[model samples]
Target: MRITLERSNLLKSLNHVHRVVERRNTIPILSNVLLRADGTALAMKATDLDLEITEETPANVEQAGATTVPAHLLYDIVRKLPDGAEVFLATTPDGGTMTIASGRSKFSLQCLPEADFPDLTAGTFSHTFKLTASDLKMLIDRTQFAISTEETRYYLNGIFFHTIEAQGDLKLRAVATDGHRLARADIKAPSGSEGMPGIIIPRKTVGELQKLVDNPEATVTIEVSDAKIRLSIGSIVMTSKLIDGTFPDYQRVIPTGNDKEMRVDCQTFAQAVDRVSTISSERGRAVKLALTDGQLLLTVNNPDSGSATDELAVSYESDAMEIGFNAKYLLDITAQLSGTDAVFLLADAGSPTLIRDTAGDDALYVLMPMRV
Candidate 1:
């Protein structure tokens, strides 16, 4: 196989695919990326058994063939090359080695036969829909932080994506939760998306897909089946296996009886939590919230360290209320609100609290109260 591609184009495509390749793998081919040249384009693909990514860039394909080369090594080489330099790649018949050259520099990278690479199914799926690049970005950014890092409950490790009815209209909702906190965001679904099956998109796939999308106004085609999902944007496509286990019925965790309400500027509230958390020790990052009339007092106390308190004018119309929560959780939830102010619905000190955006009913977050 022989092909010539621009250095900048090669670097961009390689950077997208290389992240999907694992650094250490039992199978050598898993550490390599598959490069294939078609009529006028070169495709770079990398997979980790569970997720597969393919990126295509414009190139001059003198000969149509395929080869596999070390992913990280190739990425680093092309990244260090001159920005506009043209890259030439050629492979020997034996497939024992591949030569890569840019300008005056030449390097021979060990190669594996393209047949040795793990096979991926470019399977056909039903339920195809288009999502605006910006909307998908907002869905991911608003809920990904609450994804669980614990391996025991693998089902809770990804964002649950599905279509649901809101006020007699179908809406796309992304929900993520660790035991302590949960985030849910919704956006109006385009026509023909109603009745699609719910799927849990794994965390690693979410991070990879984020890189391929740039223009907020661009449209992305999404296809989902029972076990896998595909997101295609221009010359890139990402396919990932969905988690098989059932996600917890997250609706029950959302508090509806929380009558004590407080409305505060989201940015100010987030900054106050940040400052107060500084005084708390590393082990327990706890912050206290005290509400009365229209004023909110934020405090953090640590027996071994020090304490902090800050006051902010807010909109509160209920009896006095006090609650404590993990400062990190509070900050994460507040940061997701798209507008200036956030509404906090609290039941009591030991109960769950509900949070929503003041401007719209598009998204909601729930936090489990902590003992101070």
Candidate 2:
């Protein structure tokens, strides 16, 4: 295969596809990216068997052919070339090596037969829908932090997507939970998503999709089946395998009867928690929240180190109670809040607390308390 393309265009397409290639692979062709030149474009593909990404860039194709080369190596070479430089890629007659030439720099990369590269066959899609980039991003960003990293419960390692009827409307919801915390977000269901089956998108695929939905105005097409999902944005296509286990009943864990309400400035509470936790022990970094009438006091005590306490005024009318939470977890939940005031609904020191934004986003969070 032989092709010539702008360095910027090649790099942009490579940047999108090369991330799917693992750094180490047992199969020789698995670490390589497949390059095919034909019909005035060069198509680049990279995969780790479970996930695949493909992108096409405008190029001057001198010959219609295909080959595979080291993904990272090709990316590195193209990245170091001068801006606006034109990159020329050509494979040798014997198909043993591919040469890259840009201005004064030249390099040769070993080539593997394109036939050896594996394809992630998407058998049949049962549902297809379109989502605006902003909506998709909102659902992912709100719930991604709560996805469990535990390998034992593979179902919890991904964000669960499904449709449900709530408040007399069909809504598309995304939910993610580790054992300690849960995040749930919803959007008005799109037209074609009404009867779609629930699917658990794996963590890695969620991460890649998150990066691609940067343009808020762009539209993303999603095709889903029971075992796999395919997403397309512009000239890029991504296909990934879904997690193979049933997600737990997340609705049971979201507390519904938390009666105590505490309203505090989100930024102020987050900063106070950060300052108090500075003296906490590494392993036991729990911040204690003591609330009484309209006053709130944040404290962190460690026998091995000094202790800290910060007091602030809050809008709490419930009976006095003390609760402890992991300082890191508190910060994570606070960072996702968009409103100035955060409302926390609490039942007691031991029950889960519900958090919501005053700005009226369709997202809610549940956090379990830790022992002080």
Candidate 3:
């Protein structure tokens, strides 16, 4: 195969697909990316058995053929090449190596037969829908942080996605939890998404999707089956395997009886928590929140180091009480809030506390309290 393409075009497409290839792999072809040159385009594909990404870029094809080469090595070479320079790629007759030439720089990379590259076959999709990039990003960004990293409970490793009837409308919801904390976000369900089966998108796939959906104005097409999912954005397409497990009923964990409400400036409360938690040890990052009539006190105790305290005026109309929470977790949830004020709903020192962003009702969080 022989093809000529601009360095910029090659680098951009390579950057998108190379990340899906693992750095280390037992299978030889898994370490290489498949490149195919056809009529007027070059298609590049990379996979790790679980996830696959493919992208096509316009090119000048002198001959039509396909081969596989080290993905990272090729990307590095193209990245270091002079900008706006035309690149020439040609394979040897024996299909042993491919030559990369641009300006005066040249390199030869070992190649594997294109037939050896594995393909992730996406079966029939049960549902297909389109979502604006902004809406999809909002749903993923809010809930991804709470996905459980524990390997034992494999089901919680990815965000649970499904359509549910809520507030007299069909809503598409994303929910994730790690036992200690839970995050849930929702958007109006798009047409053709009704009655779709709930699916657990694996953690790695969710992370990759988050990076790809950067253009807020663009539209993304999603196709899902029971075992796999495919997302197409512009010239890039990604297919991934879904987790084969059942997600727990998350509604049971949401607190419904929390009566105490405390409203505070979101930025002020977060900064206070950050300052007080500075004296906390890595293992013990709990920060105590003492609530009274119209004031709130934050404290962190670390016998191995020192202690800290910060107080802020808040809008709390409840009896005096003290509750403890993980400072890191609190900061993470607050970072996602959009409004100037954050509202906390509490039942007791030991029960789960519900947190909401005063900006909207689309997102909510639940945090389990710690004993101080």
lDDT of 3 by residue, 137-173 (tens): 9999999999999999999999999999999999999
TM-score of model 3 vs. true structure? 0.99
TM-score of 1: 0.98
**lDDT for every model?**
0.90, 0.94, 0.96
Give the range of the ten consecutive residues with the poorest summed lDDT in model 1: 206-215
Off by over 4 Å in 1: none
Winner by lDDT: 3
Pick the winner on lDDT between candidates 1 and 2.
2
lDDT of 2 by residue, 1-372 (tens): 888999999999999999989898888898999999999999999999989999999999999899999999999999999999999999999999999999989999999999898999999999999999999999999999999999998899999999999889999999999989999999999989989989999999999999999999999999999999999999999999999989999899899999999999999999999999999988998999999999999999999888999998999999999999999988999999999999999999999999999988699999999999
The digit string of per-residue lDDT tens for model 1 on 219-323 reads: 999998889998899888888899998999999999888888888989988998999899998789889889999999999989988789999999998999788
Which is the winner by lDDT between candidate 2 and candidate 3? 3
**Worst window of 10 by summed lDDT in candidate 2:** 357-366
Could you tell me every candidate's TM-score relative to the true structure? 0.98, 0.99, 0.99
